[model samples]
Target: MNGTGNIVALKPFPDAARLELDDAQLRTNLRRATHTIRDKRLRVVGEVDDWEQLRLSGAAIKDDVLARLPELLERFEEAATKAGAVVHWARDSAEACEIVTALVKETAAREVVKVKSMATQEIGLNEALEAAGIAATETDLAELIVQLAEDTPSHILVPAIHYNRSQIREIFLSKMPGVTRGLTDEPRALAEAARKHLRAKFLTATVGISGANFAIADTGTLVVVESEGNGRMCLTLPQTLISVVGIEKILPDFSSLDVFLQLLPRSSTGERMNPYTSMWTGVTPGDGPQTTHIVLIDNGRTATLSDEVGRQALRCIRCSACLNVCPVYERVGGHAYGSVYPGPIGAILSPQMTGDGANKTLPYASTLCGACFDACPVRINIPEVLVHLRQKGPKSRAEHAAFASISWIMRDRRRYAAALRAARRGSAPLRGRGPLRRLPWPASAWTVSRDLPLPPKESFREWWAKR
Candidate 1:
């Protein structure tokens, strides 16, 4: 990715959201999924005795890493090289893709099995591989479904989250090779279908590609936390293994990882611990992959790290907790964000990563409710970053008009009362319906993406007059 390169074309938030808002099915899927995840996170997070302290510790550690990132990168490179793992530094996405492609070609592998990787998605690696005539198979079930459907991921944790099981059944039956029409949408049946589809690819794949959740600088170890066993297979089964890692993923030591292991699961999948947490240091001669490679990608991270306020986004562990709790995300879904990274985190992170471009509009995608901040295990202060980025971008016409209207309304008691009377009259018809979902013109800027409580049928001033 370049200074202005977007992970995906981010149409202005309001415009994209207008289209997403019209999709009743998408809204329903997002609401149900986010609420379920949010409730689960609250349940598991409540069990932790020192959750706040853990968040503080995690933030402090990441801040430390961000502070000394250049030094840590060198230390990590040296340690990883010493452990007999080849280390490659990529300045941008194109260079990183070229390096990985060259590595795969060296092994003469035409097909590679891939573990779900956000970094790879951000860099458009699968597309790059296809351009090079190398097939990249997504082993993650959601990823596979998206691939089969020829659709982009709409969420972080569950890429196919926008697709209901019935939709998935249709996709599998139509696109999945050898899938029987008898395949039902039952969770087990879907899992079985996907398993059978991917089993051959996993067993026969000569090269495997991945992204690291954490990279230990001192030990040259990489960690991947996953709910499914696919990542484990990708890490161990191939003759050659490659990991594309963001430079910020480097942790100084294993002791630092302890805090994160405790926080990430409860915050991400709402589990006490992951089903499969894979860790490896380079390679052992006859075990795992004899040839292991870790590509440290800078892309736009150096620029992002330079910004004092925005740098906090680097601390994100991709838990998706912020996404689950974000009202804006719950309604419009990740597609509206137009980034591999999405939700409240994406609102702040993508703009910084992509520089001054169409993504500049991303900072305004949030409601700034601070639910994201509360849910964040690492305490990234996402709302703060969103505000910081918004200040850097030019304000939208709707924002200016809304504030100007407020200024006018507050100037006189008569004006204010008239405005309130109008609001009450406008809401009277829909008074018992629900929250105000849409409003006229500039006001739609607020009500389009989020619902507002209906105005009171009678103003407090009217009651005061009666009294």
Candidate 2:
């Protein structure tokens, strides 16, 4: 695979195998978690009479923001610079990684605590930092579990959804340093264990790296909302803070934060309010992070913005509600998506980020059930985008050819009747069984995992004529 290119041939089955072996446990955890959150979200969302209107308004705001992203980004840079933040622009993941790595090296910080940042993950920042001899410790409880297990985040919000409590206990017992010899599969125990491990890092680390949930252009303020206080600690305790955020993450002003603050928490963890909603503008002397640097990353986001239908994905607040509702995502989980963003959002976002060609299969991963569209807080029409991409996809070429051939066959009624007669004659071999016991080659491959329905003995037109 190219360093920054999409992993087109990446199989979901391998990651699924690891998950399936612990199927009973994962099912129990997911069932409990998803049901609880689903109920809470429906209840809270119902309280607002204009919920649909709010969704439409949110989507419109994002569309408007994306329309003039270039202008707004420059405005953000100017404002942030005025507020004492040093702004660095990176065109791609490599440049972003290099900029972050160089910044950390210049600070001479060997260890850095991290708030859960998807941009950092997208650019492989931790790996880059490690290569530069910097240890990046993940502070989020789920992220810590993922980092310790050397596993990739399956879901954007819940990174370790693939791991059950017992699996987490196994990981802690094996990976966490100075952890108790025996660990139970209790949530409280796991959280305390993580807290002990990360508290030391938070107090001692000189630098912190984070991704903003939203960046306000008007005041140059960066926002991060999380259920855990660990993000707050990571953002505050470190002396020097480096935030890697996508340029597309910028909102026009601070007022826009109200719409997202309401949309994100309820949609994500199903909370009425997130425990920690942190916002900071540049450097504040005697406060959180005396030195602040924002690395504005444009890695494929600009390319995604250029796309008409696919651009709506940029509006995502990284709320994983769509994932929880997607049947395919519910079964295979996020690892199968093979990108930093996963599930329905990832399907549309990944192909757009990579540009459609050989990696077009990402769009087809959905069943087009529209469950994701219904669940999306921002009302991203995931099914519409999926079909749009499919039409522009590589498979469409073959489909077009098939259509032309079928059209040619159907143009002449005599040929069509002869074809149906041939079909009836050929299918005579399987008449007693009602359908062929087994097909051959390509046709057989379709039936390998499913049974084929028997064709009618007579054509519909012929039956109509007889009547």
Candidate 3:
């Protein structure tokens, strides 16, 4: 399942970032979008007087859920089943995919409409469904664009964030069936076109699949908060409905929504609240889908939970506030991280979710600016986790040797003075040179985009002795 998932980074983050950085247009798009969202979030978040207290409460709730996860999961299953939902457990991605595909096939449907779901993406569910001859159509406007363009999602909340209006117009005109050639790049026109395109799918699709923003163990309710009504349609309009949820998504009770429902929308879309918040309890017989299934997927979550510091990543509500504020994410974009979940969260989450074999370099992809933790609604200390994960990674021989030499020198006064004297002599020629140009190998890497200031002409000990 890990092998089959989208968590694997095809290349190391540095190499991927190097390639992504060359795209000026991409950088421009990312800067505009992230800044807009960042400014909006700051404004709305400021409106709440007790925002910090709310963040603390949200984190405490999620931590408690993780601590009692085993019991909470069972309670959720029991309550969901009692409410007429068929709850299924999946140990990994493969099992989750198999379970969903089988459920879809049981409805005798060739096509299924979907609400945007990170868990489904994590399992590579669409690709798996395709292999089984079932078409999983993404009904969300942004997801549909990415799917039509054969592109992976670059951002958590805005999947098509990398694409500008003109590019989106081109995609719709070229890829969308029955779309008018005159479709303009205006936001309204694009929304209209997508709405018309998805309307038929929503009406006729026999199966719908979704991921929950929250699953309440107390009442067996699954909640999805979105700006568009597509999620509501998916929740209501189908012969059968299935939801793929991560075990971490569960809350101890229905009241937990009071905190998250407030935090998620504001932190994600910069909205005081989402326009559409859809909740369902299993099935409603003739009113909605007759058959309801909930597949709770582990897929290495247990492994992630094993970590003391890293377990905090599971608290992510997918608000993506961190992505909108991250400097590295703004410049290089999400594709560089090579995961559906990107930015500060992905750098920590993706590595622990899969293993050391995949995304080995992700932990290093940060400035440790601490912006992410500040933006996080649940207050995941992402930089702390990133540093923790970095410590767990394979040590660099050159770095280890360099630190070892420094340690050895610091332990003895003679070596320290000798090292200082050598440095002073080597830097004398470059003194008052402002900043040295790119130096030779090893040091060249640091000097490429940064200045290397010349050291003092004499060591402190030498100056004292001469005086």
Task: Report the C-alpha lDDT of model 3 over 350-424, residue by residue, as the tens digit.
Answer: 988887444879998899999999999999999999999999988779878988989999999988888888887
Superposition-based RMSD of candidate 2 using all C-alpha atoms, in angstroms: 2.9
What is the TM-score ranking, best to worst?
A: 3, 2, 1
Tell me the lDDT of model 3 at 101.
95
Ordered by lDDT, highest first, the candidates read 3, 1, 2
User: What's the lDDT for all of these models?
Assistant: 0.88, 0.82, 0.91
The positional error of residue 382 in candidate 2, measured at the CA in angstroms, is 1.0
lDDT (Cα, 0-100) at 454 in candidate 2: 63
In the range 175-273, model 1's lDDT, one tens digit per residue, is 998998889999899999999999888898989999999999888999999978999999999999999999999899999988999999899989899
Measured against the true structure, the TM-scores of the candidates, in listed sequence, are 0.87, 0.91, 0.96
Clashing pairs in 3: none
Question: Which prediction has more favorable lDDT, 1 or 2?
Answer: 1
Scored by Cα lDDT, where does model 2 land? 0.82
